[model samples]
Target: MSVELWAQPAMMSDPAPEQMMEHILKRVGDIPPLPVVATKILSMVNDPDLEVDDLVSVIQKDQGLTAKILRVSNSAFFGLCRTITTVKEAVVTLGLNNIRNQVIALCARSMLETRAEGYALEAGGLWEHSLGTAFCAERLSSTLGLKGTADQVFVGGLLHDIGKSILSYYVATRFQPILRLVDGEGLTFVEAETQELGFDHAEIGARVALRWNLPEALVDMIAHHHGPSRESKNRTQVCIVHVADAIASMLGLGLGVGGLENRIDDEAIAHLGVDDQVVQDVMVHMSSIGDLRAHIGIN
Candidate 1:
């Protein structure tokens, strides 16, 4: 609240989560908007009674989106022998949910491809990392036998770091010291954030997602991803996303300002039942991950 608080020295610990969340919400405003097609598709698909005709009509409105969906369906990722020529055909073949997730993924690329200089993420770096995490989450969810759609988990992973975009301008100007602290001063990213900015990026990102009216489960994952121990409902989903992010960060797919300390979350690992063997399996499948990542066009 005071100038002194902004200049406070780095401490070994984090602040109370509630205080941090409040400050981030009060300080940040007017996040970038989701693409019109993405917003409309999210609204349509989320409606329980919406029919396939309704989805086809909406996809028809955006000619580019229709083509992209068809392309994605026929791509090696989906592995269909037949071509998907029409929006309705793709929806029928790929299923409504997978089509919806691809639309979101396409829109997210346009939204996040700009480099956020403040966080030291190059143009497209955040997009690539987000996509990789989403891919990882989808695989992990299937492995865990989770109840929800893997496509939804993939979308959650894609937008998990939307808050980084919200604070890019501030990080460029007011919080440059935070970056220096994290790198040269041997501080954890969260610790550096608390010392220099009076808050951390994860909470800031969570607030941005909340403002966008994303599902509360997603908002919770973005908010408490770093503090998975605090998450209650959908803890497995949150942990999936949390560990996915750590793995993405470690793989150097989109190394942002957050360094290697952003490695895998041990708590999330234990929470999700991901053990040494699972990690090895994921690594063995890295080539498959790369193929999927490339197909998503986040590269």
Candidate 2:
């Protein structure tokens, strides 16, 4: 109790996990808010009444985001016959859903590009994994007929691991002990995290999403992406992100110190009505991962 828990989370030796959650929540408050333009674009997904003009209007407010949006829109991935000359043209040609996905991707690149010190996620490692998962989630939703826009599913896959960004430092300090829980006791990475740090990254990720004012569904997806609870209200959506995260791991996108200790949830598979073959097809189809990096991740 005497130690500065928040200031020195890395140095703590198995302090109270319950108390640690309180401090972790407070520390996450220090993470900067999402760009206003990014926030408004997400709102468009929630508000059907918001038209394409409204989308263009908010995106144009930030010229950097606007340029990135147009550049991505005209990429060969979309196979546009003509160049996208403006934000409005990009939105109209590519459609609002894809445009929103681009905005979120750019925001995710900014937020996830940092090296998570504890998880040993090097520069671009986390971003690469996140983008891979986003591609899988968006694809899986379509293959399963999940009745949601690609961006809606993409949001969960992309940000499911956001909590790791903040927890990296704390995990680094307790890495040896946490690894003991995994190696000696055979716990998953998340179980070790919760036992040692009080809350796992998924729990902290939900808190971060909440702080960013992300939609409840998206927040819930991040919350249960690791292991969906029996009582979870958003099981279907969580299953999509969970499965996508597992697929990303299988592809070895960004395992870092987390490694392959965590197994994919079978319940998630059943909920989405998918099997290994379906997952395999999705993995094979993830070739366009670089297309996104070119538009958003690359400076």
Q: How accurate is candidate 1 locally (lDDT)?
A: 0.68
* Tens digit per residue, CA lDDT, model 2, 1-299: 11122325543455587667777777654556789988777766656576888888899999888888877787766777888899989888877777887788787776687777678888778888888788888888888877564566688888888888767777887899988998999887788888888788888889878888888878888898888766777778788888888888888888887657547787877777898778878888875454547643344
Q: State which candidate has the highest TM-score.
A: 2
Clashing pairs in 2: 17-198, 118-168
lDDT of 2: 0.77
Candidate 1, 54-155: lDDT as tens digits: 878887888887777777777776677888888889888877776777788887775567676667788877778788788777777777776354655677
Q: How well does candidate 2 score on lDDT at residue 164? A: 80
Per-candidate clash tally: 1, 2
- lDDT scores for all predictions? 0.68, 0.77
